[model samples]
Target chain A: MSLLEVKNLCVSFSAKGKEFAVLDNVELSVEQGSIMGIAGVSGAGKTTLLRTLNLLQRPASGKIAFDGVDIMSVSQEELRVLRRRIGVIFQSYNLFRNKTVARNIAFPVIIEGVNKKKALEKAREIAEELELIHRLGSYPSQLSGGEQQRVSIARALITNPRMILLDEPTSALDPFLTSRILRLVKRVNSVHGVTVIIVTHDMSVIKRVCDQIAYLEKGKMVFCGPTHDYFSEYYLSVSHDDHAAEQLEKAKKILAENGGNKLVRLVFWGEAAGEPILWKCSKGLDVSVNILYGEIEEFKHGPFGTLLVATCGKDSAEFLRRLSGNVYKMEVLT
Target chain B: MISELTRATLESLYMIFASGLLSILLGMPLGIILYTCAGSKRLASVYRVMDVSVNIFRSVPFIILILLLIPVTRRVTGTIIGPNAAIFNLTVAAVPFFGRLTENALNTLPRGVSDSAQAMGVTYRQFVFMVLVPETLPDHILNASVLLINLVTYTAIAGAVGAGGLGQLAINYGYYRFQWNVVLYSVIILVLISQGIQLLGTSLSRMLRK
Candidate 1:
């Protein structure tokens, strides 16, 4: 079921007497109890969209229905109540430097008028769960970046929010810390049934934890679907191969130098991912195939692979047609 | 001479304590107002009025301010030539001074602090008292110490106009009567007090640092 529905969402910022849309007529829907990753390059309005989701930044015009209520039209008092149900964690952790770890975790409950002693107790329990009990008395500055991030997560979770929005939560952490945070996020989602909407530029993060993915480019959501589908369609761009673009460039060079050779990019997911579809197609169509580059990675749902191949034969066109029908996606590079 | 010096010192301390306390109490809210209003679209006009008012009052020379406030001082305290009347003037001047200082202290906090607080559903009042004020307490203390030291100097200026403190003693006996030794003693005491407040503020601020 759709837990949050955003339609025709428009957000703009005016600077130096000029106005520009940060998010223009964007549309999205997040299913209940699912992890949705919003991915985009910097200045692509990913963060703006996340901020708009929690009503931290009001849009210029749009309809945002959260948990079946029109949040944009709610009164200030009602808005506050609605915000409490949705937790937000920032890129920098945003822990209270002045407060101890325990106090920082307990702050939301205290704001809700819970007794101070009870709030502290609740904070201690959450700190324990997040493996931060030993650092409870320390301030945010004293803790490591990962510890601070956990304290922030503990704070968000202590409120028992139905949904949590994390903005680049692991961008600053090392790989080991990043995995730990992702594990905690997954545990929170499954164990507590909390819906998660995370905005990140890292595709690996999306592959590790997100069930669905949304791709934004220049303030417009260009793709939104299951995680596997996004990878299949935009494999070259989103591949963990930092050299995907460079490799593609090199492939194009080779294709141009080797006359009469065809360069094709193929994406395979699900059942086709495990089969030798490329080899079969080459043999059946009587084409010579040279594998240029390939990557097979496991996503949350299953395995997805992208392969770039160079083919040379009289029946290259027939080979391409057969491969296109077998693979999830096929595109001509050169 | 010893007894008179003691009396002047006590009177100076009294005026400083009363005016400094009043300034902090009043100025803190003013500073919060300035910080909060500056960020609020609905309160843009309120921010402008306050910003201009603080600038206007801050620009007027302190000595000139005392003179200009004489009639108003008399209206409040029913006397315009003693420590009590000077306190009314001192507090009026120092309130805006400290208010601006508080605003600067609050501004030094990372923007994320307040943004996180708001995301957690805190009201504006709660944000100021619970998050903004506490987060900036160390800076606030340092700012307050600076204000208190300024207050000490202003008190001496007030004493020049018969406000009855160390300044009056120094001006009457040393400046007018040419008693250099008297001036030396008062100067030494003023320096001691200023250093003392600075030491206290620095220590307190350090202790509060997380």
Candidate 2:
């Protein structure tokens, strides 16, 4: 069953005397013990959609059900109690500058009337998990951007929220820190069985943690499914790097040989991208070679991508002998 | 000479202290109300009415205001001319001035701070006490110092209505009696006092700054 459900959500804003509808009937769901990804580019209303999940930005019209309770129908006093169950992290970190890291993390709990000692203890517990225990007494101004974001995550998670909404929690973070925070998020979900909905442009964030991924385009959800399926379908479209295209074509032919029509085009990079695939393929003659379309380019991780080519050409034996195990392949589209 | 100088300084200080404290009490909240009520987009018409009232009061010169308020001052305090009467008029004058100063101070704060507080479920009263007050503290202190300095000068002008202070001392014992020594000394003291306040205020504000 879905722990949090947003159905028929719409959001609009008024600017310069004209109202513009930003979110158009977006719907999403997150099950308990799952990390759900809402993947979108900037200005795709990803933040607006995330804000609607907790009614931070009240939708123009929608139904948000949390564990079967329609949050929209609750009174203001009751909604505060409901909000306590839903923690939210922002892209900006949003740490209160006047407070120390521990106090900042403990604010939501303190607001809920948790005693100072208890709130600090809870904050400390989450801080240790996020690896922010050492800086609990430091103020937000004293920490780096990444450290502040970790404190924000610790703050949100300290509430023991049934479900948490993370809005680009790592966008402001450096790559190393981003990976660390995402790992912590996964740990929170798996170890604690808490539902997590992360809105982010980082595909690795989805791949590393998310159980399901939903793609949002211009306020509309275009795709929603398991992370592996999301990677199979949409991940390729995002990695239009020339090298990724070459590797993708090769994998297609190999997967198709095994009757794997629904294939996941995994792009390799660094040592993985340059692996000796053709050398291994020399022994397998049944896998013919056909390079229909191939592109290669340098990336931060080196050349990687789709090799959208058929593996069954007349010179297939020669092709297989020439480029043998050095290549990967998947089936051509029917 | 030192004893007389000390007594004169103490009297001047007393006049300034009494007027400044009274003005703050009367003006700060009025300024807050004027700014908050009028500054609101939802209450634009009410804001306009308040704006007109403040403008009318502010446009009148302090000396003229003191003269005009003599009857009201007499009715309120049973005295037409004295340090007490001057305190009443000076406070009345400072209200509109500080009201404008406070309005500008509040305007300098980031709109995000206010919106964030509201979104966090803070009530209007708590917004004022917690968010708005903290964000505007630096500006508020600066304006209050400026208002105190202005009140010091206003109290001097109150001497024209038979009020007693350094201004009266200068006119009564120095200018009228041709004791230029007393007038020169009083003028020097006033300048030194105002300069001290400005310096103290600036340093204190700098110390308070993050």
Candidate 3:
């Protein structure tokens, strides 16, 4: 069973007695010990979806099952245990302004009746792993933005939760700090084998740290798949037209230069994706193929590529027809 | 004359501190309830009642409130005239005033502070004591200072009901007997007390700021 399964979840807010759906018919499943990113533009309900999983924003209707137990039907005591098991980090970092870094991290542990001294020790250990040991005595306001975010991460981890939900963890950080935070998230997943569900508007964040991807749009789950598939498919599905158009323009220019040539765009996934497919396909086509545009992206699973190939004095339709059997997407542009 | 001045000054302090502390203890919770009820979807009716009631009670003149609480004051303290009675009336009047101020202070907290606390899986009770109260503590201190400064004026007015304080001494020796020295000394002492409270409160608020 998946570690967390949200099936057909719906949530609404009633303002002035009119109900507005915030999360509509959202379904998602996250496995144990995997890092998944939920990507969307603002108002897409990504954060709301994460909140629903934690049951913070109680969904109007849905069944969220964690470890085969329906979270919606759990008793209050069981719900508390469920909440403790699923940690959430907000964009603001939310370190209690008055408490020192160690105490802020120690708070949830102490609430569960751990000895304050032992809790602080546990906090220091996590802070050390996150490279925040030196700032343990500092208050939240005293830390820089990046340091504060690490402290927030430590506070979330101190509970030893099975899953952690991060909502725009790097939105307020600089580029260098953003990379550091992403690396920390990756390390936490690899080292601890903990499940992490991150909500972010930044595609770079998803590409950097997430093994799986969930795309939310207008309160709907538009796409969910492995990271490699997302990398190849995301650009095609979205309006990041410049990146796609740049390659297409190069292919077009080559096709124009090589009079009567065709532009064949190929997308490959899994073991089927790599350098050898280009060689074999060209050799099979019996025509000298000029590589117009080429790029390969490495995702969590493996490698994927979107290649724009062209041929002189020949149409590439026959070549593409054959290539379609092996690759995920193949299109002939003339 | 010196002894009399000292006694009036002490009486004023007694009334302000005793009633101020009691008012805070009672009013802060009242303010919390009002805030929680106002924010929660299920507590709309409770919020409406409390909101309107606070507004109404706040609008009542302090002198009228003092007179209105007289019977209960006498019942509680077993005396209708003295510092004890003044304290009782002062406390009852201050509860809604300070409650409103506490509510305002809590309202000034950024929404994210509360949202993050709820996301942390804190129970409602824990959210109040641990997060809500402390998150708004700096503002609460400032608000308390304003309330206390305002209450100093209220206490002097309580002297109208034979509550012994500088106001009574000024009325007896300065106004009725026309002794300008008694009036001037009392006014100067009151000014010092007000300044001391204002300065100490402002600095304390500044020191604890996040």
Candidate 4:
């Protein structure tokens, strides 16, 4: 089940007497245990969308459901409680100048009404995990940017939030620090099953950590799919290449019995999907097959994607003519 | 000569301490007000009123302020010509000067500091008292020291109008009687007093700075 579902979200801002729509009718979802990355250029409304998730900016109109509960329907106190379950880290590492590193981490815990000592202990625990145990007493000015961001991550993690929204958490860091932060985030997701949502202009960040990616352009979601397949040419992949010649001869023989027609591959998901479609197509047509590259992908559910090819003879053409109405070409590997 | 110097030194210290305290107590808040209101687009009208009043007060020289306040001083404290009366006039002049100084110091702060505090869920009041004020403390102290130096000169003028302190002593024995040695000694002591206040202010600000 989806842990968070945002439908048709819209956000706009009026600054200096001009209205700009930052996010327009954007939709997104996160499954129970998946990291989703929202990748966009600056001012593509990635930050605005992340802010809207926690009600930092109320949507002009939309439904945001966290664990199947409508977020906008909750009372102010209840919303605060809900927000506690969704931690947010900022790009600028907004650590309080007057507060020490420890105090900055302890802020959200204190907001949740945890006693000072208990909150400090929890903060210390996370601080140790982030490798900032010794620098807790130092003010923000004394620490490097990477150290400050680590504290910010530690602070977000201390809440044990069900979902964490990271807004360009590594944008200010150098390469070394970026890797360290990415590792920390990966570790957080792997060990704790925390649902992570990151808004980043950095493609490397998207590639390194996200399981699924949603690409936003001009405040609209242009692409939303699994990480590997979204940008890949994967419509044609076939396994069992050793038997490729054998399958091709058999499929060709079957297609020769029928008149010339169209031949198409109806790509289906999972192991159960491709076999039946292929069998049904063969029984219904005289199949002259050109078995291309076919492969099976093991998705979150089960094996998915089947690549096949056929050359329709006369009767197969008639059958192919009927079947061409519904199918997508994965690729022309030949 | 030593005894004479000692007595005059005590009197100078008294004038500095008493008038300095009065100016700061009244002046600091006025300074905060001037800062919060002046040049802030949110409080443009308040800035205008404050601007006009501060200009009027600042335009009047210290000597004239002391002279003008004589009757008002008599009305308030029932005396127009003593060290106490001198303090009243000194505060009147010092507050506007110090307030403007304070406003300028606060204005020089990076706008990001306040904006960042607001984003942290800090209330507007806490932003002012905790972040804004503390961040500007070093500059505020520096300006206050400058005011203290100016007040030393003003205090001597206060002596010309019967507000007796070292200034009265200088004028009566040295300037009036042509005892240039006495005037020279008084001038030397006043310079020392200002120098001491400046050194203290600088060290204290250094300690407070990051």
Candidate 5:
């Protein structure tokens, strides 16, 4: 079973005595030991979904099952216990102002019944891993924002949770710092075999670390699939840009001149864009491969995008069949 | 005369500390509870009740509040005309006042602090004791100082109602007997004590901040 399964979750908030739904009928499945990205614009309920995984935000109606156990049905006592197994790092990096860095990192462990000495020792180890050992004695107020965020991440890891939910972990960070934290998160997931669900607005962050991506829009999961598919799918779903439209117009004119039933448009959704598959095939065969419009973009998983091309002549059908191996879809636009 | 003035000052100090300690012990939690329940639908009724209750207690003038508590004071302390009785009366008036003050200070904490505490998996009770209280320590100290200084004023008024302290000395010798020098000394001592508490609170708050 997946580590986390959210089925038809819904959350509502009453503002000025008017009830409004923030999340509506959202379903998601997170596999064990996999890094998943939750990406969306503001007000899309990305943070709400992450909170539901830890049962921090209760959905009005839905089933959130962690490790095949129904979290929504658990008693308050059980829920507290369940919460310890799922760690959460908030966007605000809320460090207890009265605590030193070491104590802040040890807080979760101490609360879990570990003695203070052992908790602090464990905190030292995690801080070392996060390169924050030197700041152990400093209070959060004394540290820079990046250092405070490091303490927060170290605190989340000290408990050895099964899954960790990060809400915009690097939203306020610079690009360089953002990548560094993303790499750290990737390392934590891979090294600990822990499932991770990150809520972020940065596509580059998702591409850099996430294997699967869920995109939310207006409190709905508009798309959820492999990271590679998200790249191609997102591009496909956007209204056709002027360049692509203009390329299609030219392709239609060329197709009319070619005067054949075999004229076709080809689109590739993977790294095949960097290859010369079309040039190789049409060169040997009696085929003409006219590149109508082609674009390639590097994505998290690998290179992902679509290329548009037109082909015609006797070997066009066979060429199209051979080319289908590299492309996600091949459409005959005559 | 010096010994008598010294004893009156000590009596005022005793009343302020006792009532201040009791008020903080009782009211800080009450305030935190009110803060935790702020805007929560489940605790809306409790919050409103406590809000109104605090407002009512705060509305009563200190002298009248002390008189109103005489019967209860007699039951608790078996007397109502000494510094000890003034402590009880002062605490009774101070609890709701300081409770509201504590609530307001806690409300000024960063919004994310509480959410992060809960997300960290601490229980509601733990959140208050460990996260909420510690995070707002500076604000709490300042609130306590304000409450204590107010208690100083209240204790002086309590002294006028047969509760022996600076107020009683100031009234018996200064007002009733027309000894203007005694009134001047009492005012000076009260002002000095209030300034001392405020200074300590300010330095402690600044030190605790970073």
Candidate 6:
């Protein structure tokens, strides 16, 4: 069953007497016990979508159902109850500067009127799990960025929330810290059964921890599907580097100059990603293949990649036809 | 001479303590209200009125403020001469000053602190007492210390107007009778009190900082 569902959501902001839409008719659904990543460029409304999920930013119009309840029409008391079930971690960590780490982690439960001693004990247990037990007494200022991020994760997990929304959780960390935090997120999902909806610009983050991916552009969800499919179908559009496009252009130029019959782009995923389809096709069909560019990325499901190549031979058409049958996708760039 | 000096010192202390307590009790809430009001769209007009009032009060000189408040002081204390009446004036003067200090202190708090509190679904009461108050307490203490020192000087000025304290002793003996010794002693005592308050405030804020 879907843990959360959004339909026809619209959010807008008025600035200087002009109303501008920040999110326009966006739709999404997150399955129970699954990890989904939301990716977009700056000002693409990625953060706004995340905030709207928790009702931090109310939409102008839409329906959001959480755990089979339409949250948009819920009473204030019911809304509060829904909020308790969904934890949110911000980009800046936002630990209370005056509170000790222990107090910061235990703050949610403490406000719920839980016994202070019991809350702190539960906080300690979470801190230990997140490897922050030693810094329990220290203030947030004393910890490094990675440790602060861990503390934030610990606080989010301590509430035993059925779902957690992380807004650019690893945007401020280095690569090593990013991977460590991602590993912790995966563990939280697997061990605690918490549904995760993380908004990030980093593809590696999506590849590492997310089972599904959603791409937002200009406040609209452009693509949403399984992780490998995003890598296969829409990876180039989201990748900031224009290397693949450049390579495709270069391959076209070479094909034009060298009189090659066709320049082709191929995508591989799952079992096809492991097979040497290009080499087998060339040797089997007596065609000469020139690999212009290739990149393979590891996703949660498996390896997915894109390749651009130039082909020239008597049986090049047969080689192309044979290669198309084995690959996930084939595009002719002649 | 020693007994007179002691009496004047005690009187000054009484004025400072009473006015300081009253100003903080009134002022801290004013500060919190101002801070809260500024963030609210519905309270924009209320914030404007309170902001203008605070600025107007803070702009007037303290000595002139005492003179202007004589009628109000008389109504409150039934007399315009003595430490009690002086305290009434001092509190009136200090509340706005402390309230502005509080607003500035709360302003220095990061926006995320409140955002996180709201995300946790805290009640409005818990957000104020648990998050807002404690987050800014150290700044409050430091501002209060500064307020206390200002109150001490105000107390002395009030004494010059028949509120019996060190200021009256210095003026009557040292200024009129040319007994420079009394002025010297009073200056030393006032300096000591200011220094003591500053020291206490610094350490208390430091202890509460983390």
Point to the candidate with the largest lDDT.
1
Encode model 4's per-residue lDDT on B81-180: one tens digit a residue.
8777887888889888888887887786665454434333444465577667777788888887888888888888888878787898889888899988
For every model shown, what is its TM-score relative to the native structure?
0.92, 0.77, 0.93, 0.67, 0.92, 0.93
Give residue A4's lDDT in candidate 1 (0 to 100).
93
- Residue A228 CA displacement from its true place in model 6, Å: 2.2
Return the top candidate by DockQ.
Answer: 1
Clashing pairs in 1: none
Weakest ten-residue segment in model 4 chain A by summed lDDT? A325-334
In Å, residue B109's CA in model 2 sits off its true spot by 4.7
Score residue B46 of candidate 1 by CA lDDT. 96
lDDT of 6 at A204: 86
Cα error of candidate 5 at position A176, Å: 1.0
Write the candidate numbers in order of decreasing DockQ.
1, 5, 6, 3, 2, 4
User: Which ranking of candidates, highest TM-score first?
Assistant: 3, 6, 5, 1, 2, 4
For residues A1-334, what per-residue lDDT tens digits would candidate 3 score against the true structure?
A: 4798888999998999899998888888898999989998999999888888877778999889987889899876678777887778888877788778888988888778789899999998998898989998888889988888888888888888888999999889889888888888888888887799999998878877787899888888888877777666654542556778777776677667667466677787768876587666656565667777777766656676777777653535665666778788776766
Tens digit of lDDT per residue, candidate 6, span A106-220?
A: 9999988999999999999999999899999999999998888888888888889999999998889888888888888888999999999999998889988899999999999
Task: TM-score for candidate 3, please give it.
Answer: 0.93
Give stretches of model 3 more than 4 Å off. Answer: A15-17, A235-242, A245-250, A253-257, A270-274, A312-328
| Per-prediction share of native contacts kept | 0.67, 0.02, 0.50, 0.02, 0.59, 0.61
DockQ: the better of candidates 1 and 3: 1
Worst 10 residues of 5 chain B by lDDT: B112-121
- After superposition, which runs of candidate 2 have C-alpha atoms over 4 Å from their true positions? A67-69, A115-137, A235-287, A290-309, A313-331, B1-8, B22-52, B103-120, B173-178
lDDT tens string, model 1, A4-109?
Answer: 9999999999999999999989999999999999999999999999999878899999999999999999988788888899999998888888899989999999
- Candidate 5 lDDT, A1-334, residue by residue in tens: 5898888889998899999998889888888998999998998999888877776677889888899999888887787788888878889888888899998999998877899999999999999999999999999888988898899889888889999889899889998899899889989998998899999998888888998999898898888878877765544533425755666677678767866445454545446766777776666677777665666666555675566666667887778778776576655655
Query: Could you give the CAPRI-style class of model 5?
Result: medium
Interface RMSD of predicted model 5: 1.4
Lowest summed lDDT over 10 consecutive residues: which window, candidate 6 chain B? B115-124
Is candidate 3 or 5 superior in TM-score? 3
Q: Model 5, residue A244: displacement in angstroms? A: 6.2
